[model samples]
Target: MAGWMNLVNEWLVPALVLSSLAAHLVVVVLAAVRRREASGWPRAILWLANQAADLAATQTLGNLFLGSTSREKHLVAFWVSFLLIHMGRPDNISAYSMEDSVLSARSVIEAIFQIAGAIYVLIKHIIIGGGGGGDGRTFVLASITMFLVGIVKYAERIGALWLGDLGSIQSSGKKLKRASLSVGHLEISDDEQALQAAHRLLHITKGAFADYSSDEVEHKSSHANDEQARLAAARRLLHIARGTFADGNDNGSRWSWSQGWEQLFRLVEMELSLMYDVLYTKAAVIHTWHGYCIRFASLHFTAIAFWLFSLSSKDGYRWSDVYITYLLLIVTFLLEVRWLLSALASTWTYAFLINTNSGLRHAALCSGRWRRLRRFVMSLDLCRLALVRDPSSYRMWSGKIGQYNLLSECTHDMTSFYRTLAQRFGSEDSWKEYKYCYSGVLHISSPVRNILFNNIWDKLKLAYKPEEMRAMAAMPVPHDNDARRRNKLDKALRFAPELQDYILTYHLATDIFLQCSGQKGAACAFVKTIEVLSNYMLFLSVVRPYMLPGLKIHSLYTATRDALHDIW
Candidate 1:
């Protein structure tokens, strides 16, 4: 019976623990690479991570409490270290779904149960004699240190889920707003009262429970240091209609450069970034000095435990058990170092880089590989979108930006035929890499964004209150010589008042100009680019109406959508 029990302990228990840890490590790698895409793979990986962590925890406790093998103390230390490193998951993602965030209370309860189990294992095995002989002193010390760190790490995740709930965010917004910052006046036509009302919204929306100091971003928002800020600014401009291509509100939109749409966009993006950090990153808990102090204490404790284990005798322990203990020690240190690097790469660190003394900032930016590191920190995009070139182009923006006819549907079949033909003839490398689209969205280069924004701004100037127009005229256009020309937006903008007219005309024009002429046309790629953008911009209008107060709602999205079947 004693020999049989040792066989089970060495083989079955070890297998269970190794399987759990191996599954967790694989899931961690997949989640890091694919979390951004809205796909089934990410969901599957998150599920595996959660399940593996639980399995590992249960196995660790089992080995600690019931083991009689001579290698018991070493296995206990190894399992505890496994739990700690597993707890230190990637910061950018916590829960896989909104429902997961809502279940945060349950998560906390489960964490409490796990903690209790771990404590029970410790008292029964180390303090008593369940671990069976040998100096268990050093093993208990190390297990305690890892348990504390793991507990705190798990607690942070549950707390982040609670914070991440959109309902909680909305509730906080309602309580906040002790004082509203003055948004400057928008002097526009009385015909465009919607535009005027939109301007009345305050930039910094504070939650009543805790004050969010959004004004801290004032200087940061002023500069276009990252792509998000630039995109947000483009959305703030009021020259486009919300839906459809028809002009409605752009005539009266006017705000000064310093305090107008630009500043508002900057503030909006920053607040969202803050909320994302609270939900996904360690900003809410670990960025604090207290968090850092505890982190270092845990590290010191782990190091001390390592030293103690080295000094202690290991006469009866199996060689494999000795190797496992050292493996856990080395892996724990590696994880801690990795966590340190992740914390340093955060946006919180970027703020310090920007404001610190000139020499440090310069060194960070101009030094060898440090510049690449700084760029990585600065360009962290929370929301990334890519255009699926083929499927993405299939839809129209509010049924206005492009038109669909029975004939045009056939044209798409032709497009498909050509694409297939091209694929067959193309090199294997090119075919393999090509998507119906590429790895990106409607927005292109900076120059394109500038032209798109300025074109709408200029058109809206026609309706601005006379005084507002005069003020804008006095200030310099944010872009340079070529952008000032109206021709810059000619191709990009659908100048037609009726979105139907624009789409139908473009379809008819392209078919007649390209297919009739027996060619894809000199401007085929350009035309396709404009068409894709029009559809995407229209989609953005309906789904994210609040983001684009200027042109987000110009077209009658439902109305146009309703008419689509009839047109087809």
Candidate 2:
């Protein structure tokens, strides 16, 4: 057992060191790929890598601190710096979710320890080992160069995380001022224009999600006569519409909407994409002058370090370790190059270039060279070209909502499964309730989209005043829906005070109504829409309770499930 332990320790450092690099590669490749994918597997892998990448590197650094006499000291010291660099994930993914960002304090402490550990490893292996000759000096120089770059990269990560944290943002207490969103007849004919437009409105969406209220007094009129003009109007309308999500009084009174549901959906989807970047990615930190400067500095230092390492002596190091070191250097350079290219082609960068009164604006926008460069970058969209049959295009969120049918689940019987597992955990009622709450997802159809759009539009038309609009928000359904229906709805609302209870009550009622009124032709479409929405609301209550107000009582859902089952 002692011999086995020794053997395990002997190979663990090299294995973990290489695993760190492999995890970095996995994270970068998977982060891009996962955006286009809706499956659980790609996201699962990406989340695992996002978590394990830092752990593997940190563990490897800790093992190096134990001191190895077999490996060359200079090579080990160089590897330590690379580990520090690896701690800063690629800009494509800074945090997997907002919860990760909320732990900013813990991250700061962890980063401090990791950085200190790397510095200690450098001191132990290089400065303490003594610079013996020309090769020794070169190695020390390379290590120091990488050490500076590593620190910069780590600082960027922590800053990005801090900027994303809700507590940090709320504590700042800065009021949001509306930007002058005057595009002045700028039509979105191409992807470049659309991207720039999205970038321009990115802040509005970010503020809306963060519960920041914006003050805009000017009311802009949109005379959208054609398709391009309508799209342009829709873009500006997004700025006003964002207030509704933030619970602000502004319900798009500032701008008139002339576009259809399709254009509105597209605009909302783009804003959601931007929101993802702001919250999860490094868009909060990058897309600034300093971000650009530090990125280029990191790139240059990496190139110089690679050159210095290559020029230094490799006589004492193992051939495999030397090759692995070279591999890390080359991969790091290539990843930085990829990030640079992507940033250049990004809409955020485009908005910065055109909006700013700098020479770069001319070089990037007016010059033919930058246009061609951006065009080239667009052609190399890694996520789009990854899978030929990938269905999602130019959309961020999967345009699908989950569906959990209480009535449907209650009807299905699993006798074999019931015999084996029904009473294993709890009572039969509990098992049945648990099974009933499992959800399935379905894409929103054109009819359902139209129904939703028309309903909201009708409500908006009715509410001319801001107070009226606010009052209407509490009434999800039309008050004038036949007298009997209204009476039934009011009665149901009396018993269901919590939002979750109300949703379940309405969902069950809607399911029963649909079952009874199985009308054909046009009425069938209405029935289907009702069914979809009812199931969707139930799905949200079960699966994503945080999105809705009020706490979700599992017992309520369980009791409802059992009652519905008994009735059937």
The best candidate in terms of TM-score: 2
- Candidate 1, residues 175-285: lDDT per residue as tens digits? 544354333334332212322233233223222112222222112112122223223433333222111112232334434532333333333333434444554545556
- Stretches > 4 Å off in candidate 2: 1-3, 32-39, 68-73, 170-194, 216-239, 242-257, 386-395, 413-439, 464-499, 516-524, 550-553, 566-568
In model 1, which runs have C-alpha deviations exceeding 4 angstroms?
1-36, 39-51, 58-74, 130-134, 170-274, 341-346, 349-526, 534-568
C-alpha TM-score for every candidate: 0.55, 0.79
Residue 323 in model 1: lDDT = 73
Per-candidate clash tally: 17, 0
Instruction: Give each model's whole-structure lDDT.
Output: 0.47, 0.64
